[model samples]
Structure formats: structure tokens, C-alpha cells
Target: MNRFGKGLLVAALVGVVGMAFRVSWNALRDVATATGADETAAFLYPFVVDGLMALALVATLVLTGDARRFALRVLAAYTLASLVLNYVHGLVPQLHDEVVDWGRLADWDPANWALVLLATSLPVGSIYFGSDLVAKVLHHRPIETPTTTPNQDESAETYVNRSTADLGVSAPAPITPAPAAVALPAGPGVSLVKSTDRVPVGAVAAESTRPRRATGRVPEAARSSRPVRTAEELLIEARKVTADWSDRELTAEGIRKAVHTSPAKARVLRDTLRAERAAAREASKQAARAAGPGEAAA
Candidate 1:
């Protein structure tokens, strides 16, 4: 509920408790006087009755799950009971001997006026106390702290290494260096040779001089005449070409011109780029799904 509604409920409860206290005190005092009880007993009688009432209220609060509704019902019942008892007591001949006119405020004695004010305030007091009690009881929870040992001071790296060792992870192999490229002689008619073949000095192996089969098919060795570019090399070239081109200029023609390759190869590079992007997106989605539950628990 809103703050204003809660305030009103509190005020009403306070009034009810006050009225019950007044009624309990008056009843006890009358009984004590009739039995010739001493001054101390008379003074402490109301507290006993109020304590019992408090215990009864707490018992009711604990037993019921819906405390707000229970408190409201208690406040209403007590207010009605107090009103009925007040009406009945006013009818008694002995009680009416010094009755004041409630309608005439100026004619009312100060003591009598104070009694009336206290009686009116009882319901408000009852509502406030009842609602407050229920709120405290229902919302209260015990706090839990993590248990730890004084001797436990392990670092994260130690834990990770231990876990990996237990899982039987093998040591990584040492990396080997790649062989250096062969340098060709720098002169007229001295051409660069493919890595797979050896050419003698002062010999010119022209492309047109290469022999072809009777079936007009090139030999496997002849097919590897030009060095084949690796996937990494193709991807690097594609990236450089895309970086230089605007969004509107990213067509097959632009890619061919930028990378100095044919249209078919440019198309192949674009398809590879799209496949890599799709794989990256899938990996990100899988990572998010894996971490979702852990994040929510935290």
C-alpha cells in the first residue's frame, strides 16, 4: 500500500489499543475497589490485563498468514465492542450520576473532556500498533554469512593450476620456425621460380614453352606453375579492399579492381567474409546462452 494509506491504518490501530487499555483499566479498578485491594495492586492491575491482550494479539498475528487483513478485522471488532460497552455502561444508574453533556463542549468538565478524548483516540492507537506488529513479523528474515576457515588463503592461480593438473592436461609443444624463402637472381630474363621446382643458372623457362597433352589438358605440375594464395592471404586482401571502398562501392567490380583479381575470385572472397561473420555471430550467441543462468543467479 501507499504511505498515506499505511499512515491512516497506523492511526486507526493506535486509537483501538488506547480504548482497549482504558476499558481494561476501568474494569480492573472497579473490581479491585469492590474487593478492597491495596493501592499497589490497583496500580499494577491494568498492566497485567494489557500484557495478556498483547500476547493474544501476537498469537493471532503468528497464526494467520494474512496479517494485514487479520489486524484490520481485530481493529474493527475491538472498536465495535468498545462502543457497545460504553453505551451499556452509560445506561447504568451508578455510572450516570456525574454524566457530562457530550454535545455541549463548553459545559464539559476538563477531566470528563479528557476521558472523552482518550476514548476517541483508542481505535486510532489499536490500528497503528496492530499493523506495525504484523509488518515487523511478516517481513523479518534472518541474514546468512559465508562460512570461512582462518587457514584458507589460497590464490586463484593456484586453484586453476591444481584443477588443470587433476584434469590431466598435457604440456603444449614448442613452435618450429618456417624455412626462409629462396632469393632469385636479379637480371634480364631471370624469372621467379615456384618453391616446388629448381631452375639452373642462365636458363629461361617461358610459360608458352611448357608442353601440353594431346587431350589439351595442362599437367598437375604445370597447374601449380603459379604459387597458390593461402586463405589468410585472401582474407587480408579482402579486408584491405573493403577498407578502401565505401558502402555503395562494395560491388564485385570494386572488389576486383581493389584486390587486382578476377570477378570470380572477388565473389569467392566476399562469400568467405560472409561465412566468417556468420560463425562469429553464432559463437557470441552461444557464449551469451552459456553465461545467462550464472548471471541470473548472481
Candidate 2:
């Protein structure tokens, strides 16, 4: 989800958790008071609190894809077991001690011990919290190699050296010199695109006279770098050319027809497009250098 949606969802969850906490606390307090239990004993309510909390956390994290599904499943199962135990204990209080001796048809129940262990030990919560902390630490930790074979390391180095040699490169290779910059040709037949400044009159006129090609041809590097009509200016020229033919909808074919060319040739004209872009970049850089210190500061 986008940022706003995520924020709204988190806010809703926080509200739900806050409401659940208040409701659970009041219910627990009422139960303790009726049993004549010490109010201080309510401090141990977190174990039970955790049971419900685990269930909520498991459900929320699972739906949101925030936590591992396996961990959430474990929490969910534990919470379900706790819920069943509470229900069983409340419905059949005698079952809390009714352990049957099959041979004698007699019983010794130990369910009360189970309830005490569940409440005091907080086994599920302890495991869940510990696992979560460990997971976080492991997630951020740089993983170390679990095993190392000397031969594998040697082979890796050998492969690197071999690849460099095959490419006619030396290990720890030397840097190469950059190519010389070409000057952009100027005058009546040249166009330049300077994004940082207003379009020039010379560029506009050059673009108007430049012919559109009709087929694809890989432009020679020299020609590719040669200054030609700029695209923005070319589009303006095209707009003027099409003004007479504007009654019809224009397509690639329509534009080609107006230019008396094919789509393949138009692709070749892109070399001129590249040249214009390059010239524009050069112009912008020059403009930047020419700006006064105060202008740059501003």
C-alpha cells in the first residue's frame, strides 16, 4: 500500500488494541473482586493478558504479512488451547482434579495444576517474545559463512584472474583516457536544444529546413555527433507544416506522409535527435559555469 493507506490501517489497529485493553482490564478486575482475591494479584494478569494479546497479534501480523506465518500459527494454536482450558475449567470445576485410575475406577485430578502452570509460567508468551527478539537480531546481523572449503576460495580467485586475462585486461587494471569533446557545428542548418535557457533563433530556423528521413539506417558515429536540428524546434516546424493538413488525425504514418517518408527512416533521424540532446547538455553546463557566484548562491 501507499504511505497514507498504511498509516490509516496502523491507526485503526492501535485504536482496536487500546479498546481491547480497557475491556479486558475491567473484566479481569471484576472477576478478581468476586473471588475475594488480592488486587495486587492482578499484576499477574499479563500472562492471561498475553494469551489474548498473542491471539490478537497473531491475527493482525498474519493478515498484514508482517510476521512469519509459522510463528503466528504457533501463537494462534497456543491461544486456542488457553481459551479451551478456560472454558473447560469454568464449566466443569471438578475436572480440575479428576485424574482417573483405570484399574481401580478411582480418580486423582491434576487440572488445577495445569491452570496454575499456564497462568504463572506464561510459557507461550515467553517463547513468542524470545523468538521475536532473536528473529529481529538475526534479520539485521551480517550472516557469516557456516562452512568454508579452502579449494572453493582458491577456485574463485583463479576464475577472477582467468576472466581478466581473457578480456585483455591486467589484474588491478589501469584507467583509460576519455575521448575528446566535439564542437557543435553552428549556423543556418544547425539546431541546438538548451533545456536551461530559451530556444535560440538560429536553432529554430535550422530545424525548419532539415529534411525528415523515411527509413531506418544506423547513423555513423561522426554524423551522430554532428550538430543538427533540435527535436523541440523540429516539433514546432512540424506543427507549422501540419497546420494545413490538421483536418485529419495524425499518426506515425500521417507524420511520415507529411514528411514524405516511412517510419523506418524516421528512426534514423533520431541520430540528429541524440546530437541535439548532447548539445543541450553542453549548453546547460556552460550556462552553469557562466553564472555569477551570487546567482549560484541564490
Candidate 3:
């Protein structure tokens, strides 16, 4: 509904509640007076009943679980009590003129005693019960539950495969390095071993010359960082690395890994090392052929 319609509805509700309260207030006052209240006491008695009803109604809306049910019970009891008093007021036209005579009912001892007790004690009851209910409701707390499931920990393999799938590439299988191939960051000075499997791209391995410590800490020397070596310096290191090689099948990839240089620079370094090895082999073969005649003559 629009604001104007809402405003009109609220105004209408206020008018209706006010009219209802005005009608019942006098009836409640008459019931108090008939139940043995003095003139001054009767005047303020309507608030005791009506005020508790209001509090109970509001509490019923605010509370939950057992507290809500208690509030509802309080509201229903006060509402019924108010209805009974209002009904009594309607039965006697003399009550409207403030000339109610309770002398006949007062002669019945038990009935009059109960009526007086109910009316006099309700204000004190309203004070304690109504205040306690409101306090309990105000202090109430609720446990909140999570609405969504939390994410689980991701494994390195799953992360790698997912990342590769996103890039539209096949996930590479794990491979062992070739016998002559060196691991990336080989400048750290690890022992080289012979293995027949090819090392796939972005793969690396490490083997220590010393046995691993069972204490689970890497040796201090193994934890050292790689020193910054230039291209020429790395080529010098690479020549020393390949000097004990069994064949001339050294790859640029392996050279780049061993020395931590660019692919282009590794290719140049590999070509230079291969040509040097080839020339040395040729000179050795020529020397062996030339010395064969001299050895035979001797």
C-alpha cells in the first residue's frame, strides 16, 4: 500500500482503540468499586487491569518458546477478567449512574471474600509477573546456524590440474630425469645420478651426497641460497658439469636448468660445449691413428 493508505489505516486503528478503551474504562472502575474499593482507589483501578493486558499482549509478540506461551496465558486471563467485569457492568443499568449496590452479594461471605481478594491483589500481581516476563524476553538470546557449507582444503595436484585445464593444456605426468640431465638450480651443488626417464617441463629433483638426517631438518649447507651467477659464469659452470659426461646428448633445457639461464643463452652454451667436445674427439682419433704406426715399429 502507498504511504497515504498506510497512514489512513493507522489513524483508523488509533481511533478504534481509543473508543474501545473509553467504553471499558468506566466499567472496570465500577467493578473495582463494587468489589470494596474506596472512591479514590476505584478511580485508578482500571489501569491495573488494562495496563497488564497491554504488557502481556506486547510480550506475547516479543517472546518465543515457553516464554511466549506464558505471555499468551497472561494475556488470555486478563482479557477474560476484563470481559467479565464489562459484562457485569452491562447487566446493571444502575452501574452507569454510579449507584451500584453490592450489599446482597456482600452478605454471601465466600463470594464477597473472593471478589475482594481478586480485585485488590491483581495490581501487585501485574507489577511482579508483567515486569518479570518483559525482563526475560529482553534478555533472551538465540543461537544462529550457518546457512552455507565451508570450502575444504585443496591439494597441490588438484590445484595444478585445475589451473592447467583452465589454460587448455594437458596436465603433464611426473617423469624421472635422464642420466646426464641436471636439476634446476643445480648451482646449489647436489650430487648428480643416472635415471633413464626424461624430466618433463617445470619438473625438478634433488639428491644429497650425504645421507638424509633422521632428525627431519635439512643440513645447513643444503639450505643455502643460489649465488647470482652471470651468463658467462654459468657457462663456465656448465662446462665443468658436462666434462664427465658419457655422451654428447646434452640439451638446452638441461643446460638452462643446471645454470639458471635463459633458453637462448642455454642453447648457445650447449652448442659451444658440443662443438668443443666434437673437436676434441676428432683430434684424439687422429692422434691414435698416427701413433699406431710408431707403436707397431717399436
Q: Total backbone clashes of model 1? A: 26
Per-residue lDDT tens digits for candidate 3, residues 109-143, read 78657656666678888888888887978898765
- The runs of at least 3 residues in candidate 2 whose Cα sits more than 4 Å from the true structure, single-residue gaps closed, are 1-6, 26-38, 47-70, 85-110, 123-298
Clashes of each: 26, 9, 0
Q: How would you encode candidate 2's per-residue C-alpha lDDT over 1-298 as one tens digit per residue?
A: 9999999999999899677656555544333333333567554453454454555464444342344554566566556655544454355433333331211111234654454444444445656654663464356434377575999889889778655555562234333434444577778956564443543334321122223344576668636563565656556555565555433344455665665455865444444444555697899998888886769689
Best by the lDDT measure: 3
lDDT of each: 0.58, 0.52, 0.76
Q: Is candidate 1 or candidate 3 better by TM-score?
A: 3
Please give, for residues 64-100, the per-residue lDDT of candidate 1 as tens digits.
4555456546545554545443443444434333242
Q: In model 2, which range of ten residues has the least summed lDDT?
A: 99-108
Q: Flag clash pairs in model 3.
A: none
Candidate 3 stretches greater than 4 Å from native: 101-111, 142-298
Which of 2 and 3 is ahead in TM-score?
A: 3
